[model samples]
Target: MRLNAAPRLPWMLGLAGLIPFVATAAATWLAPIAWQVVAIRAFLGYAAVILSFLGGVQWGVAMCRERPGETPFRARMLLAMVPSLLAWPALLLHPLTGAWVLVAGFVLVRFHECSRDGRTQLPDWYQSLRTLLTLVVLACHGLVIWRLAGA
Candidate 1:
């Protein structure tokens, strides 16, 4: 995945996406108790949002085909909703569980996007971006889990 020369938008957005995760992780270590709580909630909430966005990307890609001839539209749409469905429930669980679920969702979706059996067939560059973003997200999530466990 050669995204170095890709459009600046995805690259910029990809980097920007790290902000919440990084901030939350930093807060987990450096912020006061009240602020840490706020940061953890914010991080989990943002994780859910991003997971849904990734699902929507799959939905959009599946629906974008013009001359589609029975491409399992129903199944594709249903599959596209899986991430959001997973995310919503994760929000209701314990913080550790929720973070773990989000990490799982992120990684699972990324694998799907990159796999041949995957629902969405994205460009290599996009896959690369997803990988980078997922790594940062997982790291932040790990930090959250560690902090919560130590608490």
Candidate 2:
């Protein structure tokens, strides 16, 4: 799909959603040392939430397109739940480890989304937007990891 063909609102909202990732990542470096731990926790929490939301998006897609009792439907539903499952454990780990977990989660989701079956199920615009957003999110996670690792 042409880049401009993507709706403006989702793009706007998606970009807006990056605020917390950006802000918290910045806080990890720029905020007072006392607040750094809080910022790290906040970053992990937000990443987990967003990862779950992405899974929900997959669920929504499956619900809208697949018929009940079908193998494809079951498979898609199972895949949809994977992100939330991955995100949950990250919350209990150290900030550096948690950031790496989230990084892997985002990459796995995006990789699936780029697969042939995934490309067929989702809109071209949605796929494009997801790719872009996932890249930025991964970069933010990298920043968090860098900070947490004392780099």
Candidate 3:
């Protein structure tokens, strides 16, 4: 997909979202063993924050739909809250558990936005962007998990 397309803003923002994941993951790899826990905690915390932000975005999109009748107001509202709900507990848990929860949340949210059984959906370019972001985030989390396993 063209980078300069109408979805450029979201695409750029989505890519920018990787900064925290990459930075923390890199730090976890490079930092001393004693500092690794701190780095992982930061990574998971950042993931939870971003996940919450994404949920808000979903809520906004649903609320501002061009066709309000496409999805019932209550359903859209409930669906929109899912990410934040997931993210909150994630932050409270251990790093490993929180990372997994965020990863699952990302995958589920992407599916909710892109699937044919669409209630509230994103534009094609945006969906594609979300797919890319979700994959990268999941990979980063996988690395975190793997490192934790080997620790």
Candidate 4:
């Protein structure tokens, strides 16, 4: 699916959302030593929020696609909640550990969405956009992890 087919508003908003992740990741390296921890924390927090937001997206999709009592509906709803569950606890862990957790959450959510049944329910352009965004988000997480390790 071509990203050009996606609505302009959603596509632009999604790309704009990357600013926080990019800025925080860059700040980890560019900020003074005393402020690096602050940058890391902000990065972690933003990651958690985005992760949770992904879950909410899933939940919205499930609600729209599935009937209340269907077997797949229950499963989809349960799966939709997983990202938030992973993200909330991650906030309390060390920044390095939290980043790792967020990375895993993003990967798992994207993986699920790429499943055969998952693809059938969502628009092709959305999946394409998600793939692009997830790759960039993971790269930002990698940068933060590398910075943390070297500190």
Candidate 5:
């Protein structure tokens, strides 16, 4: 993969990634009703799984649009599922999987977007903010999982 020297990395992709995280977190934390938490987490969990797959399709779009010097990043993008896919099943079976499936899936989608254009086509601000936001989302998911487990 040729290095992208210019501002790349699809920074907006990172921000796009933040949507689910922020939305999920708000639904969980700011809501007055308790069922809202369950509704948000359950729906988001499933949606995250489906969306990651969709994001992969979008990833294909980027790969197809590959510039002359770019390396095929689709393979790397696909591999991000290792954690999420595994966690997803563990979540269903054990319920103690920390529901990391959703978190992993979310990150995979974000990483898929952020890593686009060989990491050079994106803006730096977007990447860092995305990374930060993603981590926060992951942390929130972990907390949610723990809460559900204890209940």
Candidate 6:
């Protein structure tokens, strides 16, 4: 395929990356309630889902005028996020592991593309900040999951 033809790279990559994350996320929910990992997973899962939606919108707007030949980054990004929405409700049974898997893949696509284009590279501290936020979000979700599982 032509270099440009692979423009859907971000969506594909994000989906691939999200698989393991989804698996891990599911485990958090599956873990014996005493493990208390479910809350954290739920929160991360939620944030990841929401952020991906917003990110997709941004990506779509950025490529708004690109010709039909050009890949609609935003559109595909938005499409990639669809799974996340579906996954949220699936949390009922591990919520949306499949959806989160897609989210991870989409994110990977963005991360790789950004690095490849030499455009925007998140700073080390920023990455750290994300990690911290992710942890906190995951913790919160775990609490929610715990409560749900108990009911």
Between prediction 3 and prediction 4, the one with superior TM-score is 4
Question: Residue-wise lDDT of candidate 1 within 10-119, one digit each (tens)?
Answer: 99998998998899888988999999999989999999999999889878877874234565566556668999999999999998899989989998888777777463
RMSD list, candidates in order: 2.0, 1.3, 2.3, 1.2, 6.8, 11.4
Q: Name the runs in model 2 displaced over 4 angstroms.
A: 1-3
The runs of at least 3 residues in candidate 6 whose Cα sits more than 4 Å from the true structure, single-residue gaps closed, are 1-54, 57-120
The TM-score measured for candidate 2 stands at: 0.95
How much is 108 displaced in model 3, in angstroms?
1.0
Spell out the clash pairs found in candidate 2: none
> Which should have the higher TM-score, number 1 or number 3?
1
Give the alpha-carbon lDDT of every model.
0.83, 0.87, 0.78, 0.89, 0.54, 0.46
- The top-ranked prediction according to lDDT is 4
Per-prediction TM-score, please?
0.90, 0.95, 0.86, 0.95, 0.49, 0.34
lDDT of 6 by residue, 27-95 (tens): 555667655355445445555565565455445544553344445543454544554554455444454
lDDT of 2: 0.87
Number of clashing residue pairs, candidate 6? 24
Q: What lDDT is obtained when candidate 1 is compared to the true structure?
A: 0.83
Candidate 3 TM-score, true structure as reference: 0.86
- Number of the candidate with higher TM-score, 1 or 4: 4
State the local distance difference test value for candidate 4: 0.89
What local lDDT does model 5 show for residue 128? 59
Worst 10 residues of 1 by lDDT: 65-74
Query: Can you list the residue pairs that collide in candidate 5?
Result: 8-120, 8-121, 8-122, 9-121, 9-122, 10-122
Q: What 10-residue stretch in candidate 5 is worst by lDDT?
A: 1-10
